[model samples]
Target: MSKKLLATGLAVLTLGSAPMALSHLVKDEAMQSYRQSYFTLIAMNFGPMTAMVKGDMPWDDAKMLALAEDFAAVASVDVARAFGPGSDKGTTRAKPEIWENTEDFLEKYAALQTASKGLLAAAQSGDRAAIGGAIKETGGACKACHDEYKAKDYLY
Candidate 1:
């Protein structure tokens, strides 16, 4: 092949892959902020329901269902790409084991998703007792992951 032609071919190959590489880099850069925002949203949805379940707030079935639905919607988001390599950096409580022990992290994520569904179902049923039980179960699922995958004093 001509030297000029060979150079052109190599340039084409490098440029062709640049977008994919850039995309991955962007994802990694955004992961920590995105993950933090996502969890904040989840907490926003969870807080009121927890208060209601604990009798600190008056029970409102409509509000309960709406919050549960919101929680479920957030839970359903595909976060598979949100925990990419180096995502444990910055202002995150995420443990390094999340990437090292990926399977366990994924399992915990799945359990949280399942619990969200159960909470949604219980909320839709309009039974305060059922919703309370579901909340407890869901809280357990959250704690299970938090205990192992989150660092204490991480927020500070």
Candidate 2:
């Protein structure tokens, strides 16, 4: 092919692919932000419960119930949606293994959702021991995912 023809073809190829690449970049950024916000919300609610259960904070049944409800509501969101392809590359601590081992990652996510429900039920029961056990179970569920799929460090 002529030099001019080669240049034209290269330009066309770049133009055609640029939009798709940009689209994925934008999507990945949004998903990363969404997942991070979800975890932040969960921590805000879960932290107090853990503190109360551990005696780090004074135990209040009403506050426990409220926090558990918020935790469950936040956990109910489909976190798998934020783990879509390309999201593993952005400003996120989500490990690339989440994409490689999708089934396992989702199972862990589901476990968290189930544990959150258990927590809320325990809170409603107004039994301190039950609430403590539920909080432990919920933390275990969170640890299962973090152990496998969450990275300790993120790339800037």
Candidate 3:
């Protein structure tokens, strides 16, 4: 091949790959932010539910159901992409084990989603006891993953 042709090919290849590489990097950063925001949203909904369940706050069925719905919405998100490769870098507390043992991590994530659904169902029943039980189970599911996957210093 002529030197000119080879140089042109190389330039095209490098330029073409640059966007893909940059897109992947952007996606990784976005995923990290998204993961953090998602957990924050979960906490925002869960904290109040927990207080109500613990009797620290008065029970309000309407409010509980709304909160449960919010939690379920966040929990039901497609988390598979949120933990994408390289997301463990930056200000994230996700243990490296999450990427290494992705199957187990995904299973735990699914468990939390299931628990969130259970909580939603329980909330729909308008039974404080049932809702409380569901909340406990949901919290347990969250703790299970946090215990195994999150960095120790990050735990609350």
Candidate 4:
């Protein structure tokens, strides 16, 4: 089946199987707020790494590893729980299609998680070349998701 179809199927199965639990599920606003805070952390940590890699800032091994760890922690969050119903309609750049195309978003998130781990490992290895490659791949993963599921401007 197509990704969209698969995503739809999964959504149906999940909701269909958990009616009682979902009845009291967290509010969309809470999810949106948490997701926004998570992304803010991502930006805070990722910006310095990118700047260092791009030569806009001086590099430091200890700092790179610390930032990478912070990024990895954020990447570990289960985004499937964050983009639930109505989250797209608030103070976010998240596109509504993220909820509709859940499988695609999840796959993109998995890529980001992998890239984050690679960056952490690279930072620990203290090899500049490896760290550069890891940073590039991490950036690509982020851009891939943003291109598909994030708006360039505010929805509100």
Candidate 5:
């Protein structure tokens, strides 16, 4: 090949490889953040759910409802703040595909947030039917995200 042709080929190869390399590095950080966010949000949300279920909170149904709402509000904040377009080596429990397919990840998160809000609304109404529906929706959202984004080892 002519020197010019070789140069052009090399340039093309570099351009293609660069993005892959960058994405690989980013995928690690993204995975790490996913694991951290998962653990954090679960800790925050389950506290109130358990409290309300056990009647441990010194609050009325209305107060429990408020706490549920508070929990949902923090859900989105935690994911948004913790995850990014990159992955980290430290995140073994998280899958790198989340950052790789960010749109889907964000969509799943939005669904979870919406369902969590529904749960809070139902808790506020003190209606058993509504609460059941909302809880199911929230569980669906959690399962959907976990099935797609989380590692199985973390689950078991």
Candidate 6:
């Protein structure tokens, strides 16, 4: 390879890996906020989900459907990959269990995805019974992963 081409390739590789490399070393408040946002997304979804599963509310199907869609929007990102190797910042509430039990964690997460999508479809079809069933299954997915992976401090 030409010297210029080789140097360009190295530069591209470094830039691509920079986010993972710097996540732990950097103490920027913005990075902290971004990390917090992921947690917040989970919290936001769970709150409404609990009410729906318990039938506490009037069963506003449209609202639940909308939230399910929104949940999917945030669920797709793999923050684990973003953190790369350097992402175990002391501030990170994400448990090392996430890495250790990656396959199981991913399976549970996939269950959440499937359940949420089912919830949305059931809501759209105006099937209250299906909605309840999907909600319960989705809740199970969340709890299963949380029981094993998330930190105790965050659970309470």
Number of the top candidate by TM-score? 2
lDDT, residue 150, model 1: 84
Q: Compared with the true structure, what per-residue lDDT tens digits does model 3 show for residues 30-91?
A: 87767777888899999999999899999898999999999999998987788887777876
Lowest lDDT block of 10, candidate 3: 20-29
Off by over 4 Å in 2: 1-28
User: C-alpha displacement of 81 in model 3, angstroms?
Assistant: 0.7
The residue-level lDDT of candidate 5 at 69 comes to 76
**Model 2 TM-score?**
0.81
Look at candidate 4 and give me any clashing residue pairs.
none
Looking at model 2, how many pairs of residues clash?
0
Clashing pairs in 1: none
- Number of clashes recorded per candidate: 0, 0, 0, 0, 10, 0
Q: Write the per-residue lDDT of candidate 4 for residues 1-156, one digit (tens) a residue.
A: 899999999999888889764443346567766777778888999999999999999998899989999999888887668777767776778888898898899999899999999999999898999999999999999999999998998786
Question: Which residue pairs in model 5 clash with each other?
Answer: 26-86, 26-87, 27-87, 28-87, 28-88, 29-86, 29-87, 29-88, 30-86, 30-87
Q: Give me the displacement of residue 119 in model 5, in angstroms.
A: 1.1
Per-residue error (Å), model 4, residue 140: 0.4
What lDDT does candidate 5 reach at residue 22? 51
TM-score result, candidate 4 = 0.79
Report how far off residue 110 is in candidate 5 (Å).
Answer: 0.5
Screening candidate 3 with a backbone cut-off below 3 angstroms (N, C-alpha, C), the clashing residue pairs are none
Residue lDDT tens for model 5, 1-156: 899999999999999899765553445366454556555666576566655554566536666676677767776564655665434236355577776787898898889888878888788888756765776677788889889878876421
4 versus 5: better lDDT goes to: 4
Residue 35 error, candidate 4, Å: 1.1
lDDT of 3 at 102: 96
Better of 3 and 5 by lDDT: 3
**lDDT at position 55, candidate 6:** 69
Candidate 6 lDDT by residue in tens digits, 1-156: 899999999999999999976564445444444656765786697568668768676667678777777776676666445444445444665677776777887787777777767766776777778877877777788788778876766321
Judge candidate 5 against the unseen true structure and give its global Cα lDDT, from 0 to 1. Answer: 0.68
Candidate 5, run of 10 with poorest lDDT: 84-93
